[model samples]
Target: MSNLDSQTAYWDTAATTKTFTHPLHAPWLDDVNRHAAILDYGCGYGRTMEALAQQGFDNLSGVDTSPGMITQARALHPTMRFAVLDTPPTLARPDASILFAVLTCIPSNHAQKRLIAELSRVLKPGGTLYLSDLLIQDDERNRDRYARFAEHHDAYGVFETGDGAVCRHHPSDWFPSLLADFENIDTRRITVATMNGHESAGIQILARRPSQAQVGPVDSFTAGLEDR
Candidate 1:
């Protein structure tokens, strides 16, 4: 678990150098309390956090593995709490954690699963989990990269960008199964611009952790993470 993630170094060095434009719809979080405990686990420069703050939502916090990102986030929004994660996938928030396109930065299968498991642990039953991430595109360039890296990477959608960061775009069926631990409230497919300014397929998932009475231990879902 201590193994360094490939994206971390790239992000930290280029922290103030990039801009993220992934869409985060405010209406999706309309049901959540304005003061509910909200977390953005891989928040970049605190864009989503600021957006929620503008919506009259307070009590929001963000954590990221990149010190540069945390620094930039803190500078951008001094009122909001931001932290640098030393041992990632190990969030201390003990409700209603949220993520915005975080999975796209984590290219490996196991790393992504571990982060999801940690999210399940921190989130309270019935808490909202809003996730936005990349999706596989039908374009020839993307398909070629998927095939080119298939032999080395775990997922076909995993590919390297010209700027040298490894990124993952999920298969359509992969998300529903991966997030089986959560009850689906809504899911939407949208077109979004990547940080590099390319239009790509994206997804936004609004879900809730099942009630305690309706499910088994969070560890059970984590066990399946390992089995995969």
Candidate 2:
């Protein structure tokens, strides 16, 4: 099968019966302000969005690069907003935006950086950003498994996926520096048991834009001038 087809199959099978009950999901949902505009980045099959909806998130949206995934999301949650987003939109406001699990699937490091920049740009000052992605861990077995996947799939640059799908496993230490522009609120490793019953490690990142109140007068002056 082609790589994309292989990926679709993997996710379809894996996602068909999975519950959105990861430990990280609850905390991330709690962190979002009520009625906030949240984007489920790479929202495969609308699991996260559906979970958030159950928690009373009315303004939630789902964006996925995969058309099949988007189709499924729409069919399942027709009342909620689902869109195929090639890139972040020109949002009406900043601080109201939140992206979850979006950047990890991008195949280019430069593209990932640009995506982060776009997220930061459109987020309102003091807006929150939560990201979760597979991280290279210390387990030799897991490392070898990932290495084999990389080799088999010919995955390179910032992201890679083989038999599994399009996924980018970042180094554990990489996120902090990459997100240095934002206020790093919390970083932790979350171990999740996948539907297949295998445990995987991911980095959970919580960051915030510098609020207008936090920006010093000098910086605000520059920002104001730039806005003029």
Per-candidate TM vs. native? 0.89, 0.71
Candidate lDDT values, in order: 0.71, 0.54
Compute the lDDT of residue 159 as modeled in candidate 1. 82
Q: After superposition on all CA atoms, what RMSD does each candidate show versus the true structure? A: 5.0, 8.0
Q: In candidate 1, where is summed lDDT lowest over 10 consecutive residues?
A: 219-228
lDDT of 1 by residue, 1-228 (tens): 433353677887667877787666767766667777676777768887787788887777777778888888889888888888778888665334556777777777787778877777666666667787889989998899999987787669888888888778898788888788888888888888878877888888877778772432221111011000
State the lDDT of candidate 2 residue by residue for 1-228, as single tens digits. 134322444545544444433444565456565677665655667766676678887776666545667777788888887766543433232324334444444544555666566566666677666766666656675567567667654553232333454655567667877776688777777786533455767667777777862431111000000000
The model with the greatest lDDT is: 1
How close to the true structure is residue 135 of candidate 2, measured as C-alpha lDDT? 65
- Winning candidate number (TM-score): 1
Distance from true location, Cα of 48 in model 2, Å:
0.9
